[model samples]
Target: MIQDRYSLAFRLYPYARSADQDATDPVRHPVVIMGGGPVGVALALDLGLQGIPVVVLDDHEGIGQGSRAICFSKRTLEICDRYGAAGPMLDKGIAWTLGKVFHDDRKVFEFNLLPEDGHRFPAFINLQQPWFEKFLIDRVRQAQAEGAPIALRGRNRVDAVAPRDDHVLLDITTPEGPYRIAADWLIGCDGASSPLRGMLGLGFVGEVFKDSFLIADIRMKADFPTERWFWFEPWFKSGASTLLHRQPDDIWRVDFQIGWDVDRAEELKEDNIRRRLDAMLGDGVGYDIVWSSIYTFQCRRMERFRHGRVLFAGDAAHQVSPFGARGANSGLQDVDNLGWKLGMVIRGRAPEALLDSYHEERAHGADENILHSTRATDFITPKTPISHVFRNAVLDLAERHAFARPLVNSGRLSVPCSYDGLSLTGVDGLGGPDRTRPGSPCPDAPLGDGFLLPRLGGDFVILAIDAEAPETMTQDGVTARRLAVSAAQDPSGALAARYLGAAPGAVYLIRPDQHVVARWAQYDETALRAALRRACAKE
Candidate 1:
């Protein structure tokens, strides 16, 4: 029998207790990831890439149900590329750049995601969450075949979690029996309603939006442009706002704000779904509903992501309203932020203090994502009578005036959060342009007909632009790879202009995760090494 492409099940091997040892026998690993979701699997791959041994435990045998997270951002694509899954994703996912907003019946404004010319990935890709997870699982399997030292154990549910000062203990229940395992570091990627988070006694804090949303994914044969279209109080839906997005396989992901008092069971009935679809998409439109779900989200996060040797990443640590596609994107960023630091600490290449920066930076990222999503949620569904009036006024004014257009916020969309003035490197380094600031993601540009980010992440790099490569950079026991960019590598001069506007020579100290640590107008080895140490959290 052939496996369903949408729902692929992998065989689950039993983790039976040893004949001599009972369930009390403690099997230990360096890093044990608690969820086999995208964040956990990505972290496993990232650690495996760094030659760190890991064990990933998942209760489910395969990917989750439905298209959970559909929008994949450019930064997210880059991160996936590093983990060897972006190529398949870009090919299979629907790549879109343009978006149109509507108020009532008039198409208010057309906006672009500001996609550039040189980067390999587009601004965004609309793919089902299941497909994305499948891709990640494929990469994980490939890594396992290549001896990455990663154990992906399916159907192994974590029953209990005990955090120690030095190690974390996990009680895993499988088909054969229940056994206990210990880990040097435990990452909770278990997602919202996370069991590990509850067991750890981490307090979740934030506001829950009063409005509920219904997401409907349907397969339709329509010649609609592959773009995001959102409406505020559309004539068809009267007082509600609706969002329309295109996914792969001629699938359309539609969302409508149904308010808080919805009888979800009644609302999700076939007749109700058909009525809503007919109102917006025409009654005779050739379509088949794939799936639909009602959701009410909260922009909340844990008080702390780090609890001794245990850490939280992805939806387990923070959850934002799904409007901005910040949930999984930010989760992957948390993986990116923590993966390298954890790997280094495990390898004894960096001090345990290095993990502090991960907490600081990811907490900052989670907070930033929460802030943007909260603002979007508020604008989409204002609570106060006065607030709704002002919102209506802004939407009405946006149709006529240019200045009011900027005030409209269907969703701010996920953007890279600048880690300026943080404990890791203090502030954004003195840079050529604001784009190349410290704590910002390394910009991807045409480099020798390829891209810049491909060669940057997974290691420390000293990018010397239009200047001689810095002298053998051996900084604080670790050596940095020196990249020399010339007119040839940066054929169109876009990279040079972005990194070295008018400056004669420039050096950017990039971290293992491809974040700019420091940039100097000139290459001074001493200053560069000191900056590297600061980035590594070595005072």
Candidate 2:
């Protein structure tokens, strides 16, 4: 176990006797989260802020030791920003925009993820997974202090789960004893090895590559730039491929693509790992190994994320190779897509049918991630000699030819998946910028005081850009207020460029998740009402 190598680094929520544990009858909750990882805690925070009660059950108290996931995409940072937790993350994370791909000792090609300006966040940030979870928990604490209805129970392991027609029952084992609880809605954010998923007799179906990678997080004072550097058949001759990334606290993550046939026990030896490091860093370059582990990833997901009243998010629903940083980023996107829809349903503002869209939309996302991950894995580890020759040819061309640069895939870093043509999407009559089309996440732009996204907030909003709209409108028991901003508010003209291309003005109906559901050149009350209904699945 990885935990055995490290002490209890964080005991944020030690076990304590809960009133529910003593209840004669099983206590009931509106929503119960199975795991307290980043996705679980973020969901709790999202729901808690919306006045929804959520209880998170975890076997352990706080973050475990390891620089588990270090790369976070900009879309994830934007989502975290909406939860008010991105501040701490951005403050502590090492932001990077450049990525360099090398073939052997020579650089094949380099690319910049975020070339344009006016956005609030960079392309990516490198921060240890533990710090990311801690920042989220800290926000949860602050929210709790402000009377948010969120509960975190540590050392509470859910041993069994019973699915009912309307709700799910959970049998929890705590340090004190055992207790039973029922949840109106149960969320499985457990992980890849999801116990809740197994307890329900569910399984993931997809492909698992036969290659392995060794990740060594070392504490060193090296003068390496904060960029993603990937090497194919590195000159150091340590492994087939190598990846380097910088994190906070002078910690650097080094990934070596060791072959599958190697002996795990032999490779994990301290002397063997040190020999590889010595070859890469040159002799006498001292460093301390913070954490090291070998991981083999799979591109798989459940056929359905929702089963009756129980829904799976994060690794419980889907998993992918860590190549693109899609594992955690896509999981958070699942929470973002589900949080608002679930909130509305629990509050009786939307029908239960709305929950089905969570499976539909997020399943689509999971499939997309799996496809990309599989391709990247195949490219990084060619299964046959012909494929290897083709990959090498593309790499050689990328060094000198501009068109072949696109063919080089050193893991297509995570990008937000557009939900175009999906069920919840509405009409895009405005014909404005394609980036802000229906079912697409609203892109960040610079406004007068701050950025454009923070102003949208977390709710169904009518974003009126250089257009007239009502102050607030209620449709089907759900209210959507208008945020009127003019092109003049942004001196950079990014607002007009992103939301309104050559059009005179535009009006957009944004979902609680900040995804565009409908848009028009002029505000029409009747159309807006119908769009709101469709967005809530009332149509």
Candidate 3:
């Protein structure tokens, strides 16, 4: 009956009787992820690819209606590439690098997200949320066919959760009947209104903006270029602000800031919504409303992301305004950060304390995202007349003055969160490029005919560039293999410029997630071992 809520796009995992249903004791899993959304599915895929047995539970069978999240950043694609899930997205998505901002009828300025490129992926891609989830699910299926230990259980709703000392008990309900299961590690990727969080008696604390925005995904044949266009107090006279982006299948996403006080039911009505669209798209333009929803901006996150053996990820752990396209993108980053550490701990290759770094690092990321989201919401929805005046002046000056352009924040799009100076980050002895500093996500560079990222695999790597390093090094059972490359390997000179800069030679201690843990001008076995231990939380 809950399926009535969603217009199912793909019946990925329908309810089926399982052996666990007839078990006398509760079925146990190494890791159980509740909620089969992008985050949960991606995490499962990542873990399964790492040969970790992961089970994903979802109340629904498949992706629901609506183009909920449409923008994915370059970093997201890179992470998916490691899991072999980015190819389909890149092929189907509409890539865009240019973004234009407007105030009233005049254009304020335009910016290119990726000006200088020698990278594999684009700045960002506009793809439907359903398609994104479907791609991830497909990858999961492919991974499964390749003998990965992963399971996707649909219509398996968790009615209750009992947190034990070493494991968590989950009471699940299905159409067939009720069943109980236990997990050594329980992950709550159940989303913003997380049922698991409620059962655990936890809450998110932060501000929710009063203003609301209506999102309408429509099918139109207009010639709008594949670029991000945002307007403030538009000439169309539809709403206070507007955003437009193009997705696949001729679908266009239109968002209108319709103010704080409005009739919720009346605003969603087809005719009423179309009237606003008519004003913006002109009288003759035609389009069909595919989906619609109204949402208020919220900048909030849980006090802590980890609770004993139960870990919260994605929207379950933190949430921010959707203006920056941070929701799904950040969730993928959470999987990237947590997947490796959790795998290492489960395999007994690292201390259990290593799991704490997931919270430490991702909480730092969540705070940064919330800060940006809050600032954008305040600027987009000014509370006072003086603030509005200041905003307008900044917009006016941005049109002509280059310095003022940075103040015009339609939404500061997504970027990878740096873990510099964080708990797990090791020494940064090399005076190399700041972009390649310790705790930074390794920037992609062309290596021969291929790229550098794909070669890093999902394990510790010692990237030696024109520097001497041993073939391999290990500490506390975690081994790091050397990836020796010289300036000659790259014809474009991007690899050297990005990794070495002015330094003649450099070496980097890279984490499994392809983040630089430490770097040195020259390789030293003792320092490498210590850095590896620090990265795995052994030191």
lDDT of 3 by residue, 96-170 (tens): 999999999999999999987678899899999999999999999999999999999999999899999989999
The candidate 2 region of ten consecutive residues with least summed lDDT is 1-10
Query: After TM-score superposition, what is the CA distance of residue 45 in candidate 1 from its true location, in Å?
Result: 0.5
Each model's Cα RMSD: 3.1, 1.5, 1.0
Candidate with top lDDT is 3
Backbone clashes, each candidate: 1, 0, 0
**Could you arrange the candidates by TM-score from highest to lowest?**
3, 2, 1
Error of 1 at 518 (Å): 0.3
Candidate number with the higher TM-score (1 or 2): 2
Every candidate's lDDT:
0.84, 0.91, 0.92
**For candidate 1, lDDT tens digit of each residue in 105-181?**
99889889954687888999999988888888788788889988888886678889888878988887766767788
| Candidates 1 and 3, the one with greater TM-score | 3
- Please give the distance, in angstroms, between residue 458's alpha carbon in candidate 3 and its true position after superposition: 0.8
Per-residue CA lDDT of candidate 2, range 1-539, in tens? 11222345577988888999989999999999999999999999999999999999988877787788889999899999989999999999999999999988899988999999999999899999999999999999999999999999988899999999888999998868899999999999999999999999997877878988999999999998888999999999878999999999999999999998889989999899999888888988889998999999888999889898999999999999998999999989998999999999999999998999999899998888888888888899999999999999999898999999988877988888878998899999999999999989999999988898988889999999989999999987999999999999999989999999999899999998889999999999999999999999998
